[model samples]
Target chain A: MDQRLNAKDFEDALPCDAPDSGPLRWAPPEAPLAMQKQVLETRTSWADLALVGRLFLSRRKA
Target chain B: MHSHLSPDRPTRLCRLLALSFSLIAAITASLLMAEAAARDGFGALDGARAALIFLTTAWLAWGASLALIGAPGLQRRRAQPDLRMPQPRTVILIPICNEDPLTTFARIAAIDASVAEAGVTADIAVLSDTRDEAAARRERFAFARLLRETGGEGRIFYRRRTQNVGRKAGNIEDFFRRSGSAYDLAVILDADSLMSGEAIRTMIARMQEDPKLGLLQTLPRIIGARSLFGRALQFAAGFHGPVFSRGLARMQGATGPFWGHNAIVRVRAFAGSCGLPELSGKPPFGGHILSHDYVEAALLARGGWKVEVDPSIAGSYEEGPDNVLSFARRDRRWCQGNLQHSRLLLAPGLASWSRFVFLQNIAAYVVSTLWAAFLVASFVATVTAPPPNYFPEAHQLYPVFPNTSTREITMLVFGVVGLLIIPKLTILTGAIASNRVQGFGGVIRATSSVLAEIVLTTLLAPLMLLYHSRAVLQVLSGQDGGWPANQRGEGLLGLADGWRSGRWIVLVGATALTTVYWIAPDLLIWLLPVGLPMLAAPFLIAWTSRPLTHALFRVPEEIASPPVVATYHEVCARWEMTWKNSPAEPSAGMAVEHHVPA
Candidate 1:
């Protein structure tokens, strides 16, 4: 729709999919979570432990 | 109000502003740290610290700019729905996974009754993915009890799957695979979700009016909080959430957010676009998509459907975790889901903003880990740093310590703190100016609530950093935090429970503090804000989990409960008594508030 489509345009094409049409529209790339031991441990949990803290407001999860 | 989003929302301008603010913040942080480090010859450690500080600061500034950009629309009035348009053929979907039966059913009953009163013609479906046979049996019994109460035999449906293949997403997919074609739209909600007829009506009208609008999400106000932690969260959602959401809306003009529950989706569009593909392998990254909502939003955007959020609708409500332990446990699962989304950042055919949203979601979780990394670098840099060269010249006696960096460091501290807080203070000011604080128990009480929320959240931030960091590690190591049932009505935890959950956290705090004191005592003050809280986390966790009865963090819902919220509790109360008084055999007419069709 280009996001250029407006609610006022009722004449626009309205295409619908079959209920059983199951070709997945999206797929994952290779395991992006897979990371090097050095990076994971250092970035998230250093050689021994990671010191983590900083207050910035955001709750993309919630 | 979520969307004043037009095709001409000036999103490019907002993006430019966001970019400029982030760059400025990042450069400023880097330069300030470099200036401090320059007093002693800057080492590799100093360089590492500067880079980490730059990245995290930029991320923080990006979040701040959303508030700045969206603050103006806080008090803007929403357009009324056209009542004359015929209500669309809709089905209200309540997806549950091993949730408590009576309570979950009670919420459904309230929604059903509300929709009925609103004169909306819709079928209600209780789509249960409960794998436990006993819980599934209880759901059926409670569903029958619900049917008897509402007298909605055929119009309401309850179905449970033998195998919960894709979890909640799969559960909804099962619905579409069976009866999706009969409805024009589907209102998807979680077990904890409840919406007023006004909110429901507004979403439906918006969808009906806009054919290309695939999904419309509403900002559900948190309610029914009995504990201090939950109440504080409720206040934040009611107060700060709107402005942030407005910023989100302004940034995301057409391709908006879909937060799993409390959203309406056009059946054809969703069925066409959101068939999530399991990744090529096993747990964590290579399996059923855990954060299906965001992906679905992205997919719809890919398919050219306008996804949006309407924050103006007032009656949407959901319950938050009443305590810290429950919140963190839930966060563990969400953290994994969000991490899994990093795979889709490069997915084919996604809208630009959609890809950015994925990036943003991953960044939200990853930023904590990055900040932690910055702290580690700073710690090592400070401890390993050589003694300052007091006499850089050939002359021996003259010491050369510069004090200019102290003032710059102070200014940097205030700048970072201001970036974190000024947006919220501005929102409160806007509220007071717009008389928005009237619903929050007047300006004094509302101001108190914001201040209290700030203090409580600041204390809890360290704990979240640890939790989030651990979660990222677990996911990276291919650990799957399985789908666990959400703990409702269970926020109370003993000090022992807190200790059991956070004992390692205590060790971490102790180690950092002790190490800083031993190796770099001068930097101890910098670490105390975070480290001290970690040390006392057990006590904070246990204490905050306890129930409270005060008006400090009072939200509007506390002042005047919505009709749907009132109805939910009423239905739950009546159903509970009837359920307790009647026989356990549900099919043998265990309880009936009204005559149910045989």
Candidate 2:
């Protein structure tokens, strides 16, 4: 309920003026957004079903 | 300047008064119950039962007394006026075992984004002690994807230990030994932990304001609970937990609770004092301390460093186990950890309060076994004892009627119930009066949620008693609960799985019920409350685990989740796509050095 802790206040308080020199530095992905979305959808469904199925079957077996 | 207790005598007096009230209530209730039992012609066993109940209820009363004393504090939002001081660099350590990397990294991303938005000088380290091959692969991919999504390559670092020596405690020590010098503070977090940047900054600033403050823990609200059990817990935590927490803080004085995660600690203090030495024994009783948090807090307190849990600090969040079985599993692990404290009670150089706190934690689990024993004793008394005699023997010509304990017994029950329910009602009344019930969907919804939580927990208590009793027994029998990754998120628990987990409870419940019925039908009513629930354990576990049933016990956290919760969800949603598209095969190590980040 603190007034200073609202979402917009949180978003606008970015603190990244320091020079970036860390192991996380990497080249941007070349994959297009459309292709990425398509791959992501297929993968998401497959992964979701896989996890759900595994958990469900395992519990049932127990 | 940093005395743990107050210099003012009145404050100390208040503390003593609260402590005395708890003691008196427990003593008085126990005596009354014992008196009632004695009148029924049941003797020593009943007396022992009454004594154990006294110890248990006394502990509960102590907690209730603290909550009552601290209830007013909840209404007056403890303000932390922006101190506008230079913030210390913090290393947010997210320790992971074999958990879903997608979910873990999503939480990290959320925390990282919050920190970035707040412009706080904090770095996140995804420290994994995960030994599973598949989980490690997913972890690597997830880390790389997280870096890509947030462009936080250098800001977020990932490391997986090959030899998990001491489990989570060791994993953290590895980080402190390697890179602890770089950061002034370390904010430890669990895999499911998501804390706001503002909250982290506040913690760091508060630490800066007080040089002797070694650790500051936040009361994290349970978010993302999508099951009936989880929601009930979530609701209770949001509504009832804080008042009790405030009371505990008051009782704790300077030596407060350290729940391991969603907390910040001075790196120097933690490194100097909290290097946990394994107990001289084997599994369950020895090796690595499973409940390292309490000991760590005690160590800090012993070193004259203040450890505190500030309930007023918001934006800290974590997920609860979604099902009763999962809850029991986690409790089993905690049971081993807490029971291990029995050995530490006599641990040299611990402050008197620290020793007492250890006993308190131990009692939390031990009380379950005590309750089971009390029930058994009552059953025995009912079965073995002769029926009450309305007429006296030939000593008197007139029949002298026996005294009924109905009134005394009723009063004793009411007293115990009042101790449990008063604090909750106080919190509700305070919230409604102050118009702060809006966050909980107004008074009606809030009251309904509270009622639902009470009902849910009442049904679950007997099952928990069975679980805790078994856990305590397992630990006593030298069985160790190895560090297991908590099962988070919404998932269905099949009836077969529920039965597998709860069959013992069912067996115990059935035995208790049949024994009571065959022996004394009058006592059947009393046993039914506990017994029926135990018999219904499987169904409760399976039914409450379903996401659809969550609506029945909806909490404020779910109804109006904090920004951090929403942020976590959003980040996870975005990452879900990336995780799906991520190559199963490790991409030549993702261009990272295997060693710890410099």
How many residue pairs clash in each candidate at the backbone level?
A: 3, 4
Question: Which segments of candidate 1 are over 4 A away from where they belong?
Answer: A1-62, B1-9, B73-78, B83-85, B402-404, B585-598
lDDT of 1 by residue, B1-598 (tens): 1232234537777878888999999999999998887766788888887888888889889989988888865334568665445667788898888687777898889888898888777888888887766566667667656765676766777887778888998888877877776777889988889987767887888887788899999998888787789889888988999888888887787889999999999988888888777776788887888888999998888777899876777788888888888888888888888888877777776777887888888888888899899889878876777766668789678787855467767777888888888888999998998899998889999998898888998999999999889988898998888887777877678999889988988999999999999988988998999999999999889989877775677777767777788888888777667665544523221122321110
Clashing pairs in 1: A41-A45, B1-B312, B2-B311
lDDT of 2 at B193: 87
Residue by residue across B53-151, what tens digits does model 2's lDDT show?
Answer: 788788778778777877764344555745354667678898898776666787788788888887787778888888766566657667766766677
Could you report the DockQ of all the candidates, in the order they appear?
A: 0.01, 0.02
| Cα RMSD for predicted model 1 | 13.1
> Between which residue pairs do clashes occur in model 2?
A13-B117, A15-B119, A24-B153, A24-B154
- As for candidate 2, its interface RMSD to one decimal place is 22.4
Give candidate 2 misplaced runs (Cα > 4 Å).
Answer: A1-62, B1-11, B40-42, B73-78, B81-86, B386-395, B549-556, B585-598
Look at candidate 1 and tell me the lDDT of residue B478.
Answer: 85
Query: Candidate 1 chain B: worst 10 consecutive residues by lDDT?
Result: B589-598
